[model samples]
Target chain A: MSATSPSRSEQVPLAESAPREARESAAPAWRRSPPRWHGVAEALIKTTALVAIVAIVLIFVFIAAETLPLFTSHEVRAEVTPSTMAWKQTWGEAAARWSWQPASEIPKYSIAPLIIGSLKITVVAVLVGAPLGILAAIFTSQVAPRWLREILKPTIELLAGIPSVVIGVFALLVMATWTHRLFGLEHRLNAVVAGCALSLTIIPLVFTLAEDALSSVPKSFADASLALGASKMHTVLHVMVPAALPGIAAGVVLGFGRALGETMIVVMASGNAALVSWSLGVSTRTITATIAQEMAEVVHGSPHYVVLFALGAVLLLFAFATNVLAMRIVESFRRKRGGS
Target chain B: MATIEPSQRSPGGEPRAAVLTAAPSPKLEVRGLDVFYRGEKGGETHALQDVTVDVFPREVLALIGPSGCGKSTFLRVLNRMNDTIPGARVAGKVLLEGEDILAKDYDVVTLRRRVGMVFQRPQPFPKSIFDNVAYGLRAHGLADKREITRRVEQALGRAALWDEVKDRLDAAALGLSGGQAQRLCIARALAVEPEVLLLDEPTSAPDPIATAKLEELIAELKADLTIVIVTHSMQQAARVSQRTAFFYMGRLIEVGATKQMFTRPRETRTEDYITGRFG
Candidate 1:
């Protein structure tokens, strides 16, 4: 009946055909309409991504604005200051306080002590960790057989997942106690203990990134170098390592940023007394530890709160600068890959 | 259209070659040489089977074969390059100047220095053109700045690239065109001044114009250095080499004057391959 109606004598007019086709398409659409709740995920996901990105930016802006008050040069006080606040008189007055100091009249935020402490700890950590990480990477990527590589790589990477607070507690109880016994006449919050604990944190990052870089060296370069009568060790040292240098350097910077930002490890293992000295046995403070130790107690609208945020600013700038430098190194290496 | 003609063979050449077998002075020799690469973790794939050949001083010997027929493998074995691959094995004797190369006491470094190889592709170091040529010299302990400069120039001249590169020695060698890059590789190899220069399809990556230049360089190099080249082109083999060895499935089926091999080959495979038959 349907075939005879439209086939032999006359074709359907556009008015009739259009509605028929629209109904046919809509028939299937209605079947899927019942699941609109599940389909809501598409718009929700996009909106969530937008919200998350905006939230992160806002947090960064808030941190920067709150911290700006600490720079007396930028402002007499932070723009969001309480109406009842008094002007800080002198840098000496701010710095001379035993407890948390306010931003000084001349901005004598003697971060010099904290800076020195941070550097001493970081230098020691890099000294112990960089070579260890690079050598482990070389062994895993170049010398160790596949079976050993498969076993060791995951085991080493698993160290990265271990919480810093747990590591800090171990460093505090075990490492600090052990040092107190081994070395006489020492404060427990020594930079060395914290540095060692932090080194453990960085080693996983360095080993993973360095090995990836080393392994990424083309096999052909190694072959050619070996064919030229160079030994495997020589090939790796002269060719592979040199070729993968930027990536390794990036790994080291990333590890440094991580160690610098590490709070719990430094707060617990490092003697939290904010004294400026080079002695490994004496207690010291890193920026992260200072902020963490005082963050909750500081009044929300007070200069104390803004100062901790300023400490965060210092850490953020340090990390951002390092990341930019590492990225530049990688860029230069890529440019060299126009490789004649 | 052409026929075999021994351009350099004297009447008593076979007698001389036979009598000189135990002599202390052949540039390079391989006796019953075979190289095998393990296909799997433990599986073996024969890359080259029993092979025997000699390279006389100041001679260019062409190694010709289809792809994967072990021509390059034979070249690598000449310098113990097969030893680099895991589970890759070699059996037989390679001798440089009557000194057994595979002998445990022999220094592979000295052998490689004296038997340099130019690979299929140009591999200039990431440094300047000057550094690329200076690499071997520096490795071999000729590290003085002045001596390195002089030697780099001499090697580049020998490679016929000095005139073009002399003014820009500080520029990276990677900027060179394919032909120039190949020549830079040759210069790098020659910086060590090996007695026998091994060219492993060195011109394959270059255009014809570069290839013609390379052919000229080869002709010039063989004047004082022995050369062993592997090529897929029958005409190139005939054009640049005095003698040729034909390899098939890892075996050297025929070794004779290049002219004679292409014209009246002893093996049917050689004839078929030269005449464009299935290799």
Candidate 2:
């Protein structure tokens, strides 16, 4: 009993003293609170982020304020009503069609041609760009070797950094001529040319987002599929692609939004004809191009100014709706993944 | 201490008395295997070194070791799953019934089909239970719709998960309990009808009851497939395996009958390890 007692006594003090020594050592070095500068830095960062968000909201509010006149005033209403109703009276039965001649003897401001033109270009851009971007993302994430991925991904993303005006210039000068010769279209600068140029901008956005989504898939999922004897291609096509569907959809929606709101590329290459035609080969005018081309020349507080602001409001709403739709899609995907 | 010689039983000899006394053959064999991983900074780490062992047909062989002892690497080598890792080099021979699986131009897909693996964590595809079980069959194009349904049901039954999940076969596999998900993975593997199954710490993430269920499943599976299990639990190795191999620092320290290895190990290292003297 004495031998065991001695061992226990020795162990008890050692165990007790260990923590005492640790406490003693920890006491002097420890600060009661964080440093004063750290608090200052944290507050600074928080305020900076908040300021940026507030700035964006303020800008949106200002734009909304400017566009509110269209709805509140009877002057804009009277101007819009008569011009819309007197389309045939102004340009005769044959030529007085859905047009955007805002500077004529009687300014005709039918927005149908502008909406259709924007839709035509956006549809073409999405049809050509979405598949290309998604496929490129798949190739870079799943198929390309490491070195090739490093080179190709950065190079493709660099396309996003080039100014939109530069892309517009290139499309207006080089691509339009090449496409005109290749397809033998009548109008060299047309909706097809503008849409193709716009797709160049959209491809990078779609590719970057889709690639992130594809690579975010856990490696274990791929391992399980491969362990089941599925080929690499089969795994990519079935498992990875299906898992990334929501993300790809989000990227496409964002790209569509970008296409809809693009100004410089369409202004430079769309020919700004305001033609109500479905043919991609015909010249067109989008809402963004109309605003960019006509907003400066029109008198302030006039009907044309109100109409352009109204177009601005519509474009803003469309962009907001697109973003909301994309977010909802992504959130639903997350919920499905989480619940299942 | 008497040095125990490695057994040299022929294909037509009994390998274990607890199982059938029919002619036992080596289902899988590793001879002088070495695995090296090349580090990014131009150094090589020898992960597995000069390991040699045999897995007898229709019996359970447990590989017990501490962390990073190359047990998982050895298991992966059996099915060529290590090929997926970059800069992982393997040398020496791995034979599946006297045929060299490490031979150049060997079809890895077929090898993997013959030797299915269950990971440490249950990884059921984000699909229904029936679809998860049927994934392998569909991938290999092995069965029609009717046959697939039949095989999926049979595999689930074999995994002992049929009764609990038969009512919700179309329910998402991700919604299953941990134990149920592991069993579902087993069902998925068994759906391919592989001749060998490699389980790498299949019970590590499961609770004790789930672990016991999995141990029981291993016992039942031994009647149909050759099973190699890597585990961290000594009692699990003793309870589940007919043969047990101990590995330390990338080397096979000892291999013998499980009862004999635990009770009367020949090597001092093995004795010290079993007695909790040192790892």
Candidate 3:
């Protein structure tokens, strides 16, 4: 220590005595004048971000514009008024029943079955996925050792990168046949298979966000609890979980939104039959799948075309509402935790 | 409860019969304690070496040392808190009421119930003040709701915070001032009725007036509980503790009456440290 100090002291003055130009040239790049392209790069990045925001707004406006024709189109009003359409969809004659035969002799466009189908699949996905994701997060954050945590966290995140089309194919080919054989169901591809497959996609999203929330809780809280003689499980359940509840709720809501808007998996695995049935063994068709299936075949400016655009508008509104609700929950929790 | 009678031999395995007059009963006994932090790269750092100290019942024993001198580590060893660290290894015997606390089969939960610790920074649960104090009781399942309420009130009163918080028991603990929050933490620890209290720089974050109030509370608490406090303040050690232990570079330098250690330290190192010659 004594020998090194003298050498360090001697070198300080030697460096200070060097020429100013030599010192400036020898300095690191960051210490020198920034290159001319840095400003151009910053402006370019900012402009790209603004353009992305404007593009999303324009898309929403276009969807809203296309959907407005459905409420005002004369052919739609002549076929059935909006209120009568709702009534006929809810309670109508046996022949004019709740179905989605848009190209029949008398086009039937009741959306109740489509809404119920979306709800059924979304509810099933959230119920099965939320608990598994939350528990996996808890295990990774609180219970697992350091080495195991390092391995488990990335493996679960990798589940998110698997393409939805691949999952859809897997469910359509393997899960459909196996579930049918196991339960002796009437339909080979049904809502249960699609919902289960949708849950697979939801799990990775929920797990990543929930794990982030659980891990961000201050370590001091755990220390205080353990110092007070609380066991590990008690501390985790009562203290940590409550502190992180809002983030977990946000993750679940996001997962719900994802399941509601999912197209490929539900379209492939949920035999596209627009029937208003609650049984899991039967086939169903969600609004997203309906739009995806029928939009290409309908003529432009027709009632069917406007209605598909209206469904698109509904999907947009639902996504927006769920995101807003999740943000509100997260903000309220932050305020509460801040103790103001 | 009977106290473990203090022995004639000092904690460092030395005979202190010539200088010591009367020995009080020891509330906690540590013998030849060594701590090592094993790194992932197979390197090891020795934190504490051959640290042994006896804490007498109903007395404040203040440990004074420079930073990184193992004073905090010594306090944590009393309650077996070092066990929580992943690579920490402790080798020695820590006896609380004549039972080895470091034994593998020993129940750490019960030992922690008997020995409570207060951290340097005040850490209150993000809950109602009443719930914060009632947490330990509820966790241990030692009381019903009515009993928990009674104990919570009693602990608050003992901590000298009942008058300020009696009407606001349901308020969030995080809303309290720094001093009040720290006092609430004290009440939370006191609710469990531990026999020994270990305070790690309890006044480091509070104002001078709050520090004085906490010092007074410590004085009042010594009538019922044994306290082992680790503080960096020489004046604080001189003011609160009956006995003072000086440590340097992970070794115990001197242990004697507070007045004597401050005035006529037997070792040059202790004298230099107290006299502010060097850390």
* Number of the predicted model whose DockQ against the real structure is largest: 3
Cα lDDT tens digits for candidate 2, A1-340: 9777765666665666677676455444553667799989999999999999999899788777766766677887766753472253345555456767888877778888888899999988988888999999999999998899999899889989999999999999999999999998868899899999999999999999899989988887888888877778887886788788788998999999999998999999998898878999999899999998898899998878877877777788888988998899878776655453
- lDDT order, best first, reads 3, 2, 1
What lDDT score goes with residue B231 in model 3?
94
Please state the CAPRI-style docking class of candidate 1. acceptable
How many clashing residue pairs are found in candidate 3? 0
What is the per-residue lDDT of model 1 for residues A154-266, given as tens digits with 9 covering 90 to 100? 99999899999899899988987887788763777688888888898899999999999999877766666655656667777877897788889988988888888888889
Q: Report the poorest 10 consecutive residues by lDDT, candidate 1 chain B.
A: B1-10
The weakest ten consecutive residues by lDDT in model 3 chain A span: A84-93
Return the candidate ranking by DockQ, descending: 3, 2, 1
Q: What does each candidate score in C-alpha RMSD?
A: 9.2, 5.9, 6.1
Candidate 2 interface RMSD (Å): 1.6
| Tens digits of lDDT, candidate 3, B1-279 | 122233545443334412333465467777778889899898988888886677778889999989999999898888888988889998877888779898999988888889999988888987889999999998898668899999999999999999999998988889899999889989999999999999999999749988998999999999999999999899999999988999898887888779889988889999999999887
Off by over 4 Å in 3: A1-38, A80-85, A89-96, A338-340, B1-21
Could you report the DockQ of all the candidates, in the order they appear?
A: 0.23, 0.51, 0.51
Q: Which residue pairs in candidate 2 have backbone atoms (N, alpha carbon, C) closer than 3 angstroms, thus clashing?
A: none
Q: What is the lDDT of residue A18 in candidate 3?
A: 76
Worst 10 residues of 2 chain B by lDDT: B1-10
lDDT of 3 by residue, A93-130 (tens): 46556766778877777777888899888888889888
Q: What is the two-chain DockQ of model 1?
A: 0.23
